[model samples]
Target chain A: MEATVALIAEHFNGALSPTFFELITFANKLKIVTQAKPTIVMLGEEIEEVANKATHFNGFDVIAIEVPGLASYNPETYKAVLKSFLEELKPSFVCLVQTSTGADLAPALSVKLGAACISSVQEISSESGRITFLRSVLGGKAQAVFSAMTDITVVSIQPGCFERADTGACSGNVNVSRRAYRSLRIQDLGVRPGPGCDLLLSEAKVIISAGRGIRQKQNLALLFELAAMFSRSAVGCTRPLSDSGWLNSGSQVGLSGAIVSPDLYVACGISGAQQHIAGMQGSGFVVAINTDHYAPIFNHSDVCVVCDVIEFAPELIKAIAKYRQVT
Target chain B: MRILLCIKEVPETDAPIMLDQASRWIRDNNLHCYRMNRFDECAVEEAVLIKEKFPDSILDVVTVGPKRAEKILLRALGMGVDNATHILSEHTGYLSPFITASWIAKFASDKDYDLILTGVISEDNMQGQTGPMIAELLSMPCATSVIFERISYEERLIYVEREIESGARHCMKILLPALLTVQSGINKPRYPSLSKTLRAKKLRIPVICSDALLKVETRERPELIRHPSKSRQSLILEGTLSEKALELAAILDKKSLIK
Candidate 1:
């Protein structure tokens, strides 16, 4: 039997998530490492349209499991359905997006199948007939390369790490199967919109983002003042600031919040954790001002200014004002 | 109600960490400080809140790590956990999530706890696996990234709201005897009170060596640990604060970003 690499598709509100395409990229990498046939497994209600869309990708066999009552994601239903099907298929590898759902499911699923489970895998390589997975550890200060010992390996691929795979002109066949899901213990009440729905951050041309290094909640005024200097600028923040209730949820940027690609992104006091970096890395011009010279955020920036954002913000504004008058 | 909160000791978030010789793991000797993981702090607070509500509830906090990990357990105790257990692994290097989960599950199974709690993920490994894996090992329902939870003792269920992508919340209900990996911001963890700290110092926490648990071999082994290569070549600004600011402003002006 040919080894199979299963790419678990993530969908919500009747649309495939961007992570689905990223999972395809992961599948492509696994093909290079294991020479396995790629298979896409999608679980949802009335997912035939998304399943058909997935089949357009070349060299992938699609399995669409429709559980009638599961309109939204229920971990219990997902685990129950995938467990029975994957046990029979016995895929050599299973790939999931490194999100809340994937992180929760992968390890538990591995326990059921007795497979090796690795989370937040950023890179994969095969050397001398052995495959190794690379992941960030110690808050992205270091990377760890891991090798699996079990027959089947389950991995959660980090988002924004791999480029989306191109389907080109070729397509593949999809097999749609309906499964009955009965969860007496858990029920999905659908998704509820969170508070703070400001669209300013997403629409702004320039974003001045703050992080924990901003020191105190009162210091946020410095960021706001700097942002007001520009015509179409907005104040944004990392998860910590928002978690502290200093900013609304809408102004937050990271894996669990808005992904903005502004014309210019000025990170003030931001340490540039992976989650925050994933949200703003696509900005056209990136500048990071931080007190810590070794902050990881500098690695992703175009210009790095090592200074306390509190002191530097006022000086930066003065410099900009002086430069404008001179020009 | 008996609640088991799983916590781990990790290097302080801002601690300077370096790759060890042979490039396989971090150099522990150089790390000057350690504390309860920030995410696990939320879990400990949540369990404490539940204990506060029940008043009769027993909150048992457990950690798996070397001797240095006992400090975090005591810290959790100082935050109001009723009891503490430490699974002494003795080694500081990378311990696979599977082995950790297996050890935790073995310790938790016979206790018949009403609920198990853990952090969404650790600051060190950031795997976010142990809670759900322990649940699976014990055949219990599990929830991850739970931002809010309300326990209904009468109904024997817990209603939880899990944070998903794009700030969306997925509300669900799970039966008791389940596991929840809590996300940060659920609650503000309190500082250790003087009286509680004094009391915790006198409490004797039983240390169960991991060797006493069912022997589970790690299925995944870390082969290397190194600094991540930067994708962009960032030009670090040089000189004093104002000089750097002026240089940055010039660059921004040249790009027509600031006018």
Candidate 2:
């Protein structure tokens, strides 16, 4: 039998998450690097639908572990179940999505199996007969390439980094396994809804978003004024502003907040971290304004305006007004 | 209750970082300023809050880094940590999260701490693995991205709210002697007090050499450090502020984005 590369699948609201396909894509890439069979292990209740969908992908073997009591995700149960099962398999690599659950589970799992655990892996390459995983460090300022020395390596693949794995005409085999829920130290209470839906942000055609660069809460008025210039515009911000209580959580745009793909995204004073970029990368046109010329946000932007947002916002607003009146 | 908080010192986020000559790691010479990891500051604040609530609770902060990392430990001490331990690593470079966790777990094993806390992830490395890894090494239950937590002393249990993707919150209950990786924004971290700073300055914190801990084989090694590729048509607009703004307006006008 070929050495196995296990992809841990996560699901939300009964359906396979969109990221699962990304995980499959990641596993497919890993298959090339490690020369191992790609397998997906999904844990949840009523996961048959997800398992069936997983088998449709090419070059993957799906294993659905159904624990009826696990109606929701509990780290302790996840650790307990995966620890015993993975130890027996002793796969060459374990792949997981770099989400909250994966971030929490990968480290603990590595300790259990004594395997190397790498998180937020964005790229992989094989050089000189050794496989290495590339990830960002220093808040995306630098990238670090890591090679695992252990027999078994666990990695959390960064979402939206890889192309989706192509599905072949024929489906692969999927194995269904049932496990009784052993009493766990932690108990899951399901998910509670967060501050309503962000319909304003989602529906806005133009979004002017602020970041720590706004400096103070009062400066947000400038972003709002900029947004008022457009008929369908709305104001938004990065995680720090929301975390600091300067903006409501609903107005926050990032991986943990709303994922908005407005027609025009004006990122003012945002450094363009991966989490913030993931949310707005799908925008039709992006304009980044910041004082620092090397802000990573510029890398993803179509128009990079290297200026202090506080000083530039009013100038841009005046320019827009003058241009509008003349036209 | 006894709580152990793990903090890390990191370069300011905006600090200019460059790859060394060999391209193996970042050059440390350019790092003129360092502070506690932003997430770890939240962890320190959370531990301090817990200590405030349970007056009798003892809080200890530990860090695994070189000599310069002592500054973050002192900051934690100034924030009300009763004790400080520095697991000193003489070498300067990327230390694998595995080694750091191993050293912490070894030191914590005999300390009989009831709770271990750390930031959800380090801002520099952004791995978010050390806390949970320590829990696994200690065979304790663990939670990550914890935004809210409440302890019930009589029941010896902790109720926590973990923030997942898309702003959803997962509420769970864990038994005591557990570990938690605190998410940012859980609380506003208080600045180090002047009095505490004066006292902390006079106190000598115990430092343990990395060699003192059992040598755990490093399982992963970094081969390269470089900047990420630009994924867009980054057309940097040049000229004065007004000229740039006019250029932007023209682009938007061409796209019919502006009326």
Candidate 3:
């Protein structure tokens, strides 16, 4: 195992995603387990700045594949360029953050390069001398540990799994490679900014979020009432609630939704899927209410109450009201 | 138009599931409590919607699973799918997404499907690999996490809106012979109509032994299934429902969260 290359993810709109820093951490971690050298890879048009910044920050050599894809990420183009470039490098590991782009790219790239592909990995463990990637399966109900069967492995690290390690010891060298690509099968149209983008999510002091456990649309009033109990609070929801039209997309909280770090997060009926937890785990304090005792929400909660949200929210609302009155 | 949809049969999310630690695979498959993967239900609905708009199009739904997997195909058929193909396998254990995608790709390659669609990720595996793998195997374009799409018959292209981080979306124009993995909430999946359900029941579906498909080399395998590592205190508040609520309120109040 020579090099563990961490590919920096760029947002579809060409902005650099923050997940790449975590990818560097994961790459270094995997480097330790495999005794491989660590490298950083970035793809975009004129990415010298990002590459150099990462180089100086992580103290790892950067491979900057400069292509003319700034408007949007073209999967076909990425696949074409990376297949050729990575084939030459033949690195032991190719690490990417499990964002929408990474999730879409990892499997296809693995098939192209004849590498073992693991998706949405949240943790890494070494037993004896062998290493395995651990990821949640069955919708966060359990965990699965997987081992690569091939020489080259492509692993997508789940977002929010690894804390970005500070690395400014020394600047490494950058290797620039310019490539040209023409897509015959696909064309970029553009991006539609999500509707109902809630600025309140970022500014709110408290967020009361709903999930599938809320059961029905009408039950959401309880969460709204709970949110009203606190000042500067707003109602948020998991993807399912937004998908069901019970709430707008802007009010949704998760990896693909809004990412908020309020002082207090009240999770109602949320099962605590990694996608949902990744967004709100930065909250100062957390409380979760659910009927399922094994609900994953408990894992991230400061206080976990094993009761139906429908039953619990009203009581919490009443208790908070009474406490406020007494004060 | 010829469209192909891939689906999976998974344990119902609400079912009481117990893990078999020795085998490292969850059990209760012996029972009949199974349903289509929720993400795939959205795909099934999307396929039906496309079929409705293009009434002359042929909609084929395929699943690679064990005997019990016929459930998804039947449901797809009941939802107005024209054809159902079951690549049968008895491997009750976990099947790598690569292997599953390879089998379906082999079956669909010669059919020359104009479009292929599936759920962004299966609830059971959450790998989100099969759809893109199929497209790559067939040398076609691919997209994932598609929140909305519309087909342009004249241009022979499918325009897609793929959701990215924070609900932002990237829209792309995919050539006809492309694959799209639909995200949840792309559409509300509808239940089967009584007439369609009865008609689908009477129709015998075509089944192909998964072993018959071209051998696919799997890149990874699960070594163990363990309980997820806890990231917080995970302290369970034990008491009656009201007592638990009041306790939570007290905890928040102690932190001065309630004012």
| Candidate that beats the other on lDDT, 1 or 3, i.e. the better one | 1
lDDT (Cα, tens digit) per residue for candidate 1, span B1-259 = 9999999988775656767756378777535588899999999999999988999999999999888899999999899999999999976677888899999999998999999999999988888888889999999999899999999999999999999888888899898888999998888999988899899999889999999887988899888888777866788989888888889889989998876
Candidate 2 lDDT over B139-233, as tens digits, reads 89998999999999889999999998877899989999899999988999999999998899999999999897879778888888888778789
TM-score of chain A of 3: 0.94
Interface RMSD of 3: 1.5
Per-model TM values vs. the true structure? 0.97, 0.97, 0.96
Model 3: per-residue Cα lDDT over B25-109, one tens digit each? 6663666378899999999899889988989899999998888888778888888888998999887667888899889888998
Q: What is the TM-score of chain B alone in each candidate?
A: 0.97, 0.97, 0.95
Docking quality tier of candidate 1? Answer: medium
Off by over 4 Å in 1: none
Count the clashes in each prediction.
0, 1, 0
User: What is the C-alpha lDDT profile of model 3 across A1-327, one tens digit per residue?
Assistant: 345565655543334578877887887787777788777777888687766776657778888888875445888988898899888888888888888889889999988988889999988988898789999987788898989888888999999989988766688899988988887788877666777458888789999999989899999888888898889999999999898899888998888888899999989888887788888999999888888887878888888888788987878888888889989
lDDT of 1 at A152: 95
User: Candidate order by lDDT, highest to lowest?
Assistant: 1, 2, 3
* lDDT by residue (tens digit), candidate 2, A1-327: 779988888887777778888888787777777789887898888888878887784657788899877887778888888988998877999889889888989998898988999999988889988999998877677778988898999999887787685756477777889887764688888898777446889899999999998898899989999999898889988988889999889989988898889899999999888888888889999999988776888888999998999988888998888768877
DockQ of 1: 0.77
